[model samples]
Target: MVDTRIPHLPNEILYEIAGYVDDEDILNLRLSAKVFEYITNDRFATTFFGDRAYELSPEGLEALVKITEHSVFAPHIRTVVIGHGGKHSSAKYHDLLDQAFRNLAAHGNAISIGL
Candidate 1:
């Protein structure tokens, strides 16, 4: 049997390998081993959550709230894109937007918001 397990590689080597792969490949690598998950956490968070876009709806705001609450992912978020696609005058929509803005306000790392 060929001993080709990836976990046997040093963490430095694994990180180097991660740096060479694209986002989809990196996600697959994370699924392949726990070591990959541990080593690629920062890169994964930064790559996927650095700039986020969400629709101006309850569902989208909920997702944003969840991401903002995440300790690992929240800090990596630098910009947010809120699409104004739905009805703007609904009270529920305004409420969710208010809540989302509050959450984003608390996320000090977030620098820009696009509408």
Candidate 2:
């Protein structure tokens, strides 16, 4: 049973939780409710998105593409780094990198390629 004594989470609390995790988790949580989506998009919460978030959701990808294609992030994104964590960094990784490059290129506003 739910405990009534535990106060409902304030927006700040939700925002903090969302902010602490990476984009993938945020995307999952965003689907949980409208409140959660608001929390992650709150001014303070958005600061947590990492520089290169992979294993990404289409939602996250769309948002990130919007952000980086602008002048604010355009100059900073000189390279796109694509690789599986740890031991998987081989031809498979290269192929993934190529796919990512193709995606980015089709999007075409990323400005520079790095990998």
Query: Of the candidates shown, which would achieve the greatest TM-score relative to the real structure?
Result: 1
| Model 1 lDDT tens row, 1-115 | 7556787887788889888888878889899898999998898998999899988777888898888878787888888898876565446677666666676677667458898
Return the lDDT, model 2, position 92.
Answer: 38
- The C-alpha RMSD of each candidate to the native structure, in angstroms, is 3.1, 9.8
Model 2 accuracy (lDDT, Cα): 0.49
Residue runs of model 2 more than 4 Å from their true location after superposition: 1-8, 42-115
Write down the worst ten-residue block by lDDT for model 1: 84-93
TM-score of each: 0.77, 0.31
Model 2 poorest 10 in a row by lDDT: 42-51
How big is the positional error of residue 59 in model 1, measured in Å on the Cα after superposition?
A: 0.8
lDDT of each: 0.81, 0.49
Predicted structure 1: lDDT: 0.81
Model 2 per-residue lDDT tens digits across residues 1-115: 6543313577566766776777657667777777776665643233442235543334434455554554333334435443334534345345444444555565453544323
